[model samples]
Target: MGILDDAFLKSLWVFHLATGSCNNCDIEILDCLTPRHDIERFGMLLTGSIKHADVLLVTGAVNRQCIPRIKRLYEQMPQPRLVVAIGECALSRGVFIHSYNCPLPLDHVIPVDVYIPGCPPRPEAIIAGLVKLIDQRKAQTGQAKV
Candidate 1:
């Protein structure tokens, strides 16, 4: 396999987006990168720009004002991108589901491939979700699962 294909198989550059939340989920996501989790063992990276991202790791419920921004960010990512909605807020809006500011489910905005369900999921759960995504992508592309 070429370098591009190898990169695709082993690495998944992530772009994180927050609509509106209490920041618990965000901190949990950050924790996933710490020594206990060490997501880099599976070649995951947090990217600053959506353009360089291979997966979208979104937290928080979809808010009315942030809909456009989120949609735009998803659009900016290249093809064959996957989306992982972490935490209950991103999954079902959590406690914010009935908030007047809440817009719609994440699926309403962008197609979500996998969902990590929890008020704030553990680091292991987050890494597991990412590994699942990598395996799924490898299967889809007929590449050797890393």
Candidate 2:
């Protein structure tokens, strides 16, 4: 992966995908966009297309049907992209680990760069995770912390 410059890191475009979640995590994800949280302050904006995304926020367990689709999406994402496994479901398939449909954890399908664990992680946690992601990029580029 190439180094991500400060400008790109400051205005990351994110795409959210739900494989087969219960919608709880998705709800919290949306909550981050609400006025109270104002995730935009961090320069993160949601994108409708994965091709334009700098980060992918994946929620839910990876069911058999979602594997191919996820692979396709991951392949389509632009270079220097990041994947974040949000919620317990995406991290380990949660309670669905034993389910026949959920055959793989998210990491097995796509390279996950960050993990936010919770039944439904709060907006604050999501923001913190993303901020850490930006900081990590800064460190990688040998850019001093602001």
Candidate 3:
């Protein structure tokens, strides 16, 4: 098995970066960390440090002003880290796509893995994405099929 899979299974820390949002997606991400969602049960954790994170849970549209910071954060994370664009804004810039300050899609800046489709996906969906990441990790490790 490759080392990438081992690292993925051993730890799955999420780093949230709000480029430009209305708080709905942010709240959902927070809810996943709370007792109601019980993200820890699946070995998922929210992290402040990008260096230790395995997943990037990005919310909001990529604002023109925030582009550099977003690029910086993405570059700081380790090679194997995955990015989950978690909102309509993150996926296609939502209603803000043509806004003066909005930067369009998140893929314009960094590579994205899974996209949880919603203006703000539910906490359960966030947890499901985490599980999917774990499964992807396992598959990458050759412990399971893709």
Which one is best on TM-score? Answer: 2
Between prediction 1 and prediction 2, which has the larger lDDT? 2
Per-residue error for 123 in candidate 1, Å, reads 0.6
Error of 3 at 85 (Å): 0.4
Candidate order by decreasing lDDT: 2, 1, 3
Give TM-scores for every candidate, taking all chains together and pairing residue i with residue i.
Answer: 0.92, 0.95, 0.92
Best by lDDT: 2
Which residue pairs in candidate 1 have backbone atoms (N, alpha carbon, C) closer than 3 angstroms, thus clashing?
Answer: none
Please report the TM-score between candidate 1 and the true structure: 0.92
Model 2 lDDT tens row, 1-146: 34448667879999999999999999898999999998998888989999889999999988889899999999999888899999999999999989999988999888899999999988999999998888888888877753
- The 0-to-1 C-alpha lDDT of every candidate, in the order given, reads 0.84, 0.90, 0.84
What's the lDDT of the predicted structure labeled candidate 3? 0.84
The C-alpha stretches of model 3 lying farther than 4 A from their native spots are: none
RMSD of each: 1.7, 1.7, 1.8
Q: State residue 89's C-alpha deviation in candidate 3, in Å.
A: 0.5
**Residue range with the least summed lDDT across 10 consecutive positions in model 2:** 1-10
| Model 1: per-residue Cα lDDT over 68-133, one tens digit each | 998898888897688999989888998887889986988888999999998889888898888887
